[model samples]
Every structure is written in C-alpha cells, then in structure tokens.
Target chain A: MTTSVNPLWRFRGVAGTAWFAMVYLYLPILILIVLSFNANKVATIWSGFSLQWYSVVLDNPNIMRAAKNSLIIASCATVVSTVFATLAALAMSGPTFRGQSVINAMLGLPLLAPEIVTAVASLLFFLAIGMELGLLSVLVAHVVFCIPFAYMPIRARLEGMDPRYKEAASDLYATPWATFWRITLPLLMPGVVSGAMLAFIISLDDFVITFFVAGAGATTLPVYIFGMIRMGITPEVNAISAMMLLVSILFVILSWLVGRVKQ
Target chain B: MLSASVRRTGLLAPTVITLFVFMVLPMGLMAWMSFLEPGTYGGVQWGHYSAKSYIQFLYEWDLDDQLVLNTDYVGIFLRSFLLAGGATLATLLIGFPTALYIALKDEKARNRWILLISIPFWTNLLVRTFAWMLLLRNGGLAEQFLSSIGLVKEELNILYTPTAVAIGLVYSFLPFMILPIYTSLEKMDWKLVEAAFDLGANRWMAFRRVILPLAMPGIVAGCMLVLIPALGSYFIPELLGGGKSLMIGNLIQNQFGASRNWPFGAALSFALLTVVMVTMIAYNLRFKRAPGADK
Candidate 1:
C-alpha cells in the first residue's frame, strides 16, 4: 500500500480489483449465458446442451409481439423525447429566459425521482384527463422519463458550444433557421446521438413505470417477462435475458465508441 | 433583435407549452391528488380533501395486532437510505480502485478498461435485473454450486432478500460511480503524488494524502448519481427482494394501483422531493466550502 509515486503498486492493486469487480458485476449475465446453452426447459435443470430454448423464444408469437411493441414504443419515445429535449435544451441554454431555473428543474426532476413517483403521477394525470391506459399512455410515460437523458448530454454540448458558430453562419447570410439546421444540428449530432441512445435504452429497460401505465392490450417486453416470472417462471425468460444482456453490452460499447469519435 | 426573437416562436412555443403540459402540470396534479382520499373503485373523490391519510401513515394497524400502521413508511424510507448508503459504499470501495488504476494506466489500457465497464451498462435495467434472478434463484448456479459443496443444509433461500436487492441495485448503478470517479482521477495532476513520493511518502501514503483528496469531488458526484436512484429503485427490490419487500417505491406503486390512495402516494412523493432538494442544496454548499472542489 505504501509505494506512493512508483505507479507500479497502484497498477497492481487496481488491476486486481478491476478484474474481480468485472467478474462480479457480470456473473448474473454469465450464468444466464451458461443456462441458455443448457438443454433444459427448466431454468435450474441441465437437461443437456441444445439451442431449443432459443428456437422456442423465436417461435413464440406472443414474445415476438411484445418485443415488436417494445421496439416501436422505444423508437417513438426516443425520437419524440430527444427532439423536445433538444429544443428545450436550446431554449434554456440560450438567453436567460423567465422561469429558467424552474424549467431546468422540471427537466432534471424525472431523472432524480424514482420511477414509482412518475408512474403514479402520470397514472393520476391520465385518469383525470380520461385517457385510457394503452400503448399511447406508455409512449407518453417513456417520453417523460427519456427527456432528461436527452437534455443532459445535449445541454452539456450546448453549454460548451461557441455562440460564434451561429454568429458566423448568420454573418455569411444564412437564415437563422438555416444556420440552426446546417451548423448547429451537425455539431450537436454526437450529443444528440448519445442522448437518443440513452433514451432508447431507458425506454427499453423501464418496467415499474411501464407496468403501471401499460394496460392489458399494450403489454411490452419487460412487462411480459415480469408477468412470466410471477406466474410460475419459464426458461425462455433466461434466454431472453441472455439476449438482452448481449444487446445492452453491444449498445454501451457502440455509444462509448461514438462518444469517443465525436471527441 | 426583438422581432427576430419573436419570429423564432418555433422554438419558444413548443418548449414553453410542452414543459407546462407534460412536466409541470402533471406534478402539480399529483400534489393536488395526494391531498384527497381514494374513492371506492379507484381515483380521487373529486372534491374531498384531508390531512387524514398523512396522519394515518404515522399509525396504521397491520395484519398482526402490532402498530404496523401505514406499512411503517418511515421504516421503508430509512431502510431505503441504508440500502442506498450500503450500495454507494460498495460501489465506491471497488470503483475507487478500478478508476484509479484506469486513470493511472497507459491511455490504451484505460480505454480498454472503460469499454469493459460500459458493456454491462447498455442493457436495459430489466434485463440486468432478470440476469440477477437467473443467477440467484432456486434452480440457478448459486443453489446448485452451494448444494454440491454441502453449503446448504436445505435449499438456500437467498432470493427476495435485501441482500439480493442490494446486489441488483449495485450492479445496475456501479457504472454511475465509476464514471465520475474516472473523470476526477483522469483530471488529477500526477505530479503532486510524484512530488509527495520524492519528498519521502510511500505509495499508499501518497494515494491517501494526495490522490484521494483530489479525487473526492468525483467520488461525491459518483455517490450522488448512485445514491439517488438506488434509494428510489423499485423494480430491483420488487423482483430480487420478492413481493414481501415493500420499499417506498412499492408503497407508492400500491397507492396508484391497488391501494387506490393517490393522495398518500403524492404526499410520499412530496416527501421524497423535499429530501432530495435539501440534500442537493447541502451538496452545493459543501462543494463551495471545499478548498478547490470544483476547480
């Protein structure tokens, strides 16, 4: 512990812990991966080695339907939320407007507060307004939570941005709208992409909020998996979990690489 | 300039209007609904309002003759705090080492380490939660391995405990801790530690005296990122801790769903809001007090 400036002991300690932590963090997924290849309908049983469960999950129309619904919802939520969040980011980061602090807090509060609160609040709001619980309500809920993620990276980019880029565009006789589209959008694309990716993943992973807001007909993938777990489990859930983990790991690497490229 | 600004109603109109309709108004409605009692089937009784539910929360009777009152929401709040605190501590204990190592490593090594960490982060939280269930449940690896090793007198019932909940919560949030710590460690001036070493301090001593102090800001940010959500995470405890686990999140869920007590849930949400606000203000004050915390 006492090799202060040498960098060697620091490296050794850190590397050792990093490996340990990585394995610990990933053990669950590793278990699921091991189970996926196990030839068994029972999650705990190792009947043999087979690709049957993967085929089962792929063949099941209900899971496919739910997953398709989920993809549609996530895409809609991400696109809608990211656009609004970007505009809000632009507005807040621009000239100091009235109620800017309130606006900023409103955007950020969803991120800090638990999904339970947002779910209940949205449920109450929808009820009061007579909106039925369905895919639309789920979309509304996803967009609400996704905004902060989009706003954050975009806002950071905006804050660090030089106003002169827009100014120069204007000086070159570009219309304000044109300048925003041509110059601002392209420059802001990286942050927007990361933020949208974040929004997409959040919408994909969300359960508590989605469970409450999504009604019977609009059951999303996570909710379906949750229902299966509760109603005397299934091994397909494990298979799905393995696939989801793979996708998530891929998405994270992709986002990080994209972020680095922008930098 | 004024005319040009006015012309860009394209931006202002949507921004102002959307925040009001979606963000601000929903919160306001929730606060209002929280003051009213739940109706028979569901929803508010429209005009009725009272402080009764909030008061009752302090003293509700349980299935047992004990004063189980209001599901002891106060206990749930405190337990959540403990859980969050534990997870934050665990994450930092491990994360500090990893981030320090990465920051101190060669650029290529650091990049490789970061990519490895970021991988688990991409999956949705539900997938991550399910992964844990797969690992700890009855038929899963833990029970199988432990039973094989004679670690279990009977079947090990580890799932649905607070320990399981904490594991899932920590697994989900560990990245938040690492990133901030990495940023802080990356920004550190290694020369100070080198100088301290040259002046006769050993490795651990330099790390303790120089690197740790400089890295405190990142640690604090990391803590905030992890702690805030860990306190509020409902799904992890619900799934891993099982149905018996009633964190404040579950309570809130009940209020909106089966319990049909919107008013009490609103009050609970408000309570959470006030706590978060106070903590944030305190955090800002401490940051200001620190000698060069921001810099």
Candidate 2:
C-alpha cells in the first residue's frame, strides 16, 4: 500500500469526485426516507415528523392488495427458480457435457435482452397462446429472469467447493446419491440461500415487465407505486418507496453475507 | 447405477425446459408477431404476413398511397441514442475516478465502498427514478437548494425535461459503470504503473500509457452495461421526462397501448434488440482479440 504502487490516488479531483459521487447516490435516498416520516402531505416540504404516512400506506386496501400480490409472486418465483437453478448449476458444475457452451449462452440470454423487450415478447407470447393475463402469467415471467440471478451464486459455490470430501465419501463406499446428499448439497446450502434471496428481491422490485404482464387484480407493489407516482408525488408514495428500498437493501446485504460464508 | 451423463441431463432438464418455454419461445413469438399484419382491434392477425411494420420505421403511406419519409420514430430513436450516449459519457467521467478511488482503498474499506455502490444498483429502478423526481422537480430539493444558495433566482424547472431524464439515467447506472471498472482495477498489477513511473514517465503518461489500456476491458463492459439499459429504459423517462421528452421505450409502449399497433411495437422491439446484439457482438469480438484472453 505504498504511494508508489498507485500514484493515481494523488491525482486532483479523483478522491473529491468519489466522495461527491457517493453523496450524489445516497442523498436523494436519505431525503426520501426522511420525508416519509413527514406530517405534511406535500413531499417537498419539511413539516413536523410523523409516521402517519406509513400508517396510511398500511390502511390503503389497494396498496395492501398489491403488497400481498408481490409477496406471493416473489415467494413462488424464488422457490421454483431457485430449485431449477440449483439443478442447472449442479449439472453444469459436474463433468463437461456436450452442448455446454450453447446452454451457457441460453442461460445468459435473459440477462442480455432488455427488460422492455422481454416484457413485450412475453405479452405477445401469452396473447398468441390465449393464456389469461393475470398473476399466473406474472409469476411465470418472473421465473425466467430470476433463473440467472439464482444460477450465478450456486455455480460459484460449486466451483469453489473442495472435491476431496466427495472423494473421501466415495472411498468409504458411500453411494453417489448418498455422497451428494451428505456432502455436496449441505455445502451448497449457503449459495442456494443467497441465490434465493437475490431472486426474491429481483422479483419484488421488478416494475417494467410486471407493468406489461399483470392484468386486472394482479397488481404488484412496484406497479402500484408506479401508478401512484404517475398520479402525483405524495408523502404516501415516499413512504411506500422507502419501504421497498429498505426491503431490497436488507435482502441484498443478506445475500452478500450468505455468499461470503466459507463453510 | 445411473450414469453421470443421465444424472446431469436429468438435473439440467428443468431449467432448460423452463427457459425454452418461457424465454426462447416468447422471443420467437415476438419475432413472428413483428412480421404479421396488425389486427384492427389490437394484437396481430395470424397468417397475414406483411413487411409493413419494419417498413413503417422509415416511411408511412400517405393519403395518395405513396410512401412518405416519416421521421417520427427515427427522431425518437435518435433522441434515445443521444440521451443514452450522454449518460454513458457522464458515468465514465465520474465513475472511472470513483472506481479508482475505491480500488485504491485497503481490502476492508474496498468491500465497504463496493457495498455502498451496489446497494443503489440493486435497489428498485422505479424507486430510484422517483427519488430523482423528488429532487429535480420544481419547488423540490434541487430548486430550493439552488435558490437558497443564490445560484439561481427562480425555480430550477429541471424535472420533466430531457436533462432530468439524463440525470436519472446517469444516477441509476453509475454503479454499473463503477463496479466493473473497480473489479478490473482492483485486480490490476500496480507494479506496472510503478514500472512506467520508474521509466521516467509522469503520472498522466503512466496512466495514459499503462493503466488505461489495462482497464479497457472493464470500461468497455461498463459502457455496454450502462448503454443497453439506459437505451431501453421505460420508467426513468416516464417519471422524469414527462410527455414531451419521449424515448424509444415510451414510443414502443405507446404503439402497444394507445396506437393499438402490436406489430409495430414488436418491430420496434426488434430494432432495439438489433442494436443491443450488435453492441454485444462487437464487444465480444474485441474481448476475444485482447491479449491474454482465453478462447
């Protein structure tokens, strides 16, 4: 950590800009969080503090319904996608198979394609097959993109895992299935949990695709918040946004922490 | 005993089937829809194939049935490009230094800085844009602060403008730019820069000659990550750009909603897809050609 190693730290404005950039990123979030507690209806004004906005958000039946929908969709998508992604990760991390590269590309497509395009495509596909547009459709679509988020951590964990435990288990006459159950799966649990947390947050936070796919009676929290913001900015919207932001941050930090577990 | 290959296939089948049914097939359907004629009452008419959707990007049939050069869609695409391009440039300017600053930190501080950057990245895009709306809107924090500081005598009036959209894009994607560049810089051999300095090079020369080239891959990747999402961004423009500052995402949404031209909407999506694919392919080629890149 000598100065000679990276003299660029002394470069004028680099450190200054870094600090400014941090402020730029977090200042508005802080303001929003603070204003969520304001008694004033107007979001801009700094009226006396109150938790009335949170209470109002809770009391609103429409917001409550949307929150319920978001939780259901996120839970279902997280479970299904995490299970499927774990399987895929286990397979790909095993002996090399034919068509591995093709499968890799296919797995990456959802991340590469723009969400708007994916939304439009999913809408057309649903319409073409005459599928009903509802929460089911939203749930199906959520699983598609969530696969990659769920796959990444599990795959990383598999790569980092020592092979010696499985080797030892086999040398002791343990069946392959028994070895996997006793050794591999237990070791991969942290990554699976991390991936599930990530996928859950992503499904919860999604607005663009859910906006297009969700029909009547299928509104999610983000879609509801988007509608509220379009109507006007109120402390209620600020309160709801702050809540969603906090949930995402909590899940993300937990995901990071779980992924960092060594054993 | 089950063979390993059988076990692998069994394990992989669920994800493969899910992606094929949900992701690949839907995209295929979209491509097919783009070729079919538009239905009068929304959706597309099967078996009524036509090239009109793609053609309509540049020309529209006039009253006399003659094709006329229409710039409406083209203009929107251009504006989107300009705004997204501006955002990429701005993020690079701000993000590079920020990334370097983080990379220069000790391991403990580095992790903390990255976490700070990533929290905003993983947070909801809609909420982030809404945060900007609260800041940049008239009589909002930006206006109030600027006027309070005597920097401007009147309302800032920055929100609901392209500038506001640009700001939202830059802010939302800045972390995307920083994280990749920081990854590359953190793994870089600092001794190379020291070597350059020892060889009678100044700070600028060392950076320009040694450090920049080493960081090219991450910079390129960062630019792609920022540009692609910003280009197709829907909510940022909708919340911040108002009615007048329409981007291609809004334009596509309009075709699907108000205009009732599903074919045209599908076509516009394809157009956007083409641009993204080209950018990615170009990046892949450059990356593969880079020295020491694995095949």
The number of the candidate with the highest DockQ is 2
lDDT of 1 by residue, B1-295 (tens): 4574564455556655665676667778988877787777766788888775677668764578565545466788888889889999999988988787778677777788887787777766776787777778875678888889988757667788998988887888988899889987787777787788789998778878998899998999899889887877777888898886457777677676667677877888767766776877788788746764654
- Chain B in candidate 2 has what TM-score? 0.97
Q: Candidate 2: misplaced stretches above 4 Å?
A: A1-9, A256-263, B292-295
lDDT of 2 by residue, A130-193 (tens): 9999999999999999999999999999999999999999999998889989999999998898
Correct interface contacts retained, every candidate:
0.55, 0.78
Write candidate 2's Cα lDDT for B1-295 as tens digits: 7888888899999999999999999888888889999999898889999999999999999999999999988999999999999999999999999998888878888899999999997888898789888899889988888889899898888888899999999999999999889988877888888888789988889889987988887798899999999999998898899965389999989888889999999999988988998888888877957863323
Expressed as tens digits, the lDDT of each residue in A151-207 for candidate 1 is 889988888888899999999999877998999998888778888988999899888
Candidate 2: docking tier: medium
| Consecutive 10-residue window with the lowest summed lDDT within model 2 chain B | B286-295
Clash number by candidate, in order: 11, 0
Model 2 / residue A212 / CA error / Å: 0.8
Candidates 1 onward: DockQ, in order: 0.50, 0.74
* Recovered share of real interface contacts in candidate 1: 0.55
